[model samples]
Target: MQNLGKADKTTDEIFEDHLLNFNTQQVNATRLHKDINNYLRCIRAMQTANKNLMDTLSEIYEKEWVGQDMLYVQAQNNEMLWADLAHKLADQVVTPLNTYQAQFPEMRKKIDKRGRKLIDFDAERHTVQQMQNNPNRNEAKFIRAKEQMENAKRTYEVLNSELHDELPALYDSRILFLVTNMQTLFAAEEVFHSETSKVYSELEAVVDKLAKEVQKGTLPRRAYNRPLPIANHSAPVIQNSSSMNSPPKGATTDNLPPGVLYKVKAAYKYQAEDVDELNFEVGEIIQVVEYEDPEEQQEEGWLMGVKESTGQKGLFPANFSRPI
Candidate 1:
């Protein structure tokens, strides 16, 4: 009876309480596998898009441009780094999730088999109850029913015990998988970003060289997408009326005095009124230097500036210059 597909069909209520964890795990695992596949697909798609963009750049970059050869090399390196990162994600994350999902189908089959055994166990119990209440009970029939019920009980209990132990452990295994996958994914991205950071820095240096060449007349000037880099700047210096009387000696553009804050472009020409004042033609860049007596106040709208070309430090109307 157990080997054959035969069990008594009766109106009986079968209560199964151990299936909650298994059901929840199945749902979560299925969704997780789907999401991992989608994530890998998106990564590959992004890599493809980036490769296409790099190829376009390599085609249009002319030999006349400074650092043209290096641009091609770094572009290739960028694509290679993207490919390497995608490969690692597929191997480290997607592969493990796929392996994890593989366990579910086999376990599902066993669960279905357990349900069938439970039906048999319940049917045998019902038959034995019927035999016990019969007014003209048959001894042999009662004995057979009792034996069948005992066999069904033992079989169902064995399977139920196994599943009871396995479900909680399987659920807990997800924690280890989660930790391992996240660590691997993050570690791969860290390496990819670290390597690409160096590539990006080198690319910036190449562009800086190109920009310098264009400005110095070594290469033809072309309109660029980015602005030229500027030197670091701090706040303009404050000086007392007494310190503004003379130039800082031996200061030049080549050897700027210490505490030079920033460069300012002279927008208009102003002639000197006194020995302490500055004279400049339009478009001269002046270095705004800090004074030793930063605590004292000078008259507002009159700032002391140093001419980089001549190292002449004197008072210039603050309104006449603009920060570069």
Candidate 2:
């Protein structure tokens, strides 16, 4: 009798320990699931913010800048890449995690049902144990209690065995799942940055070229069509006597106004800087004026001339105006 009692106590203690282990496993699984869900939400929020920033950049980019078309295309490509990354992450990582988490509710229900069954089994076990100590116990009632306890034990053991095997395996799989997700995310980002950086570099080069053109005062004619600002007193003006409309003293008839020593045609476009100079189109005639200082005639590369179209006088490159 003493041995039988000792055996029954040992069995009950073993079941109590199993129940405690099951509760601990359930708590750990719930905590792990919550952490993973939080991580996924954070990733999603970051992706959304990044997408908005890219869209804002595209919206505010100026149309007149060089590479405007290319900039738009690159921005679109980056947006697509970001979208693809989010989709891939959801498909490969988040979906699986959600599926795994979905199993938890069913498992919890089974655990709860198993708890009720364990209580019934313990009550039946206690009844059979007490009947064993009774001097005039009903044999049929004791047999029925023992049978009920056995059935409850089998049902609980089945659920406990399945959970004990499955939960640890599921927990272990989180490591591989995390590694795969991180590797995929980082690899995609690496490729995305590499391609986007090239596009940025090309766009920067185009911008730099435009800036250089602006500094050199070489923009297209249409870009400079606005009227020039009148000079303020603070600005210094350059004066050249040779550029004046009145002819210098020399008695020759050719020295007179509207009279020319020779005629020449402009071979190319010329941009005039000062009021003294003439802005001439290609193929326009120019009237050459003889230099008043004979010493100035020694300079072979330039000529003093009046444009036939505007009668404005200036020193022009002799090579730019071909002799008519």
Candidate 3:
């Protein structure tokens, strides 16, 4: 029988044309596979980058800073979330896509084998037809040729039917698979963002509180000297005194300098003629000043300043006076 609109073309040529069209569909499916693979690769890269970023944030988080513990916890959770996402993508999306693409090569092989079988079956039929017109035709040879044709036809039909059922189903599954993958990705991202936002807000609150405390002077200023404890006195004293009764010789208000923080009343009477010590009576005020030589101030529980009453500059026990 002649194929419509191609009377000159043989059955084999028509079959080849059909195979070419099927191959075109296969190419489209292959392209779809590549696209899906590319998408999966990008997702994996993003997951790695996200995990690295979270790790970096965790590393930089100061241990003593407010919300630092919470930041560490959040970073761990984010890493786990990313791992879970990658796992799900691999199991539910990437693996299935790979499996689907893997089938194409085997299916193409079967299609090629079926075409070969069709050609063999046609050749056997033609041989039988030609032999039937021979004056000395052998019945056994004809039967053998007919049996071979039947076997070839049955084999080709089975492969054809299997491919016909499988190919269409595989192609149709692309839509469902793509939708499921996208839904999973978006859902995971939503969860990640929601959790991270809480962490971010908490950190912001901590920063605000710290800022307010600094502004109010409740937080200790950076780089300011901390009072040292003295071995002689029980405790350091803080007091406020405006002026001294009588300034001592060589110790004038001008000699005290602008660096003097304030004056403190002596908590205890100290009598020492040592060049390094300051002689002072109880109730006398001493001007506290920044040390000209920082090495001299390193002595524990001692400050270098001038006695406001006598204007004598020397070292004295910090715990013996109350800051004014």
List CA RMSD, all candidates: 15.7, 14.2, 11.3
**TM-score of each model, paired residue for residue:** 0.60, 0.54, 0.55
> Model 3: what TM-score?
0.55
lDDT of 2 at 28: 61
Candidate 2 per-residue lDDT over residues 116-231, each given as its tens digit: 77666666777788898998999898888889889877887786677666656655665776677567767866776787688678667767876887788764333222233233
- Put down candidate 3 lDDT per residue, 43-162, tens digits, no spaces: 788879977887887787555555667767766776776677667766766677667667678867877787777666666666776787887989898889888878877876776667
Q: Determine which window of 10 residues in candidate 3 has minimal summed lDDT.
A: 239-248
**lDDT to native, each model:** 0.74, 0.64, 0.66
Instruction: Encode model 1's per-residue lDDT on 1-324: one tens digit a residue.
Output: 434646444322222344676678779989988887888899889889988987897788777787789888988999999999999999889999889888888877877877788888888897898789897999998999999999998998787778777766777898899899889989998998999899889878888997898788788544322211222234333222445434323223345547665567776677777786789988998887655444322354466579988999976765566666
**Model 2: colliding residue pairs:** none
Better of 2 and 3 by lDDT: 3
- Highest lDDT against the true fold, candidate: 1
Give me the displacement of residue 166 in model 1, in angstroms: 1.2
Off by over 4 Å in 1: 1-18, 220-324
**How many clashes does each candidate structure show, in the order listed?**
0, 0, 3
- The TM-score, computed over Cα atoms with residue i paired to residue i, of candidate 2 is 0.54
Report the number of backbone clashes for model 2. 0
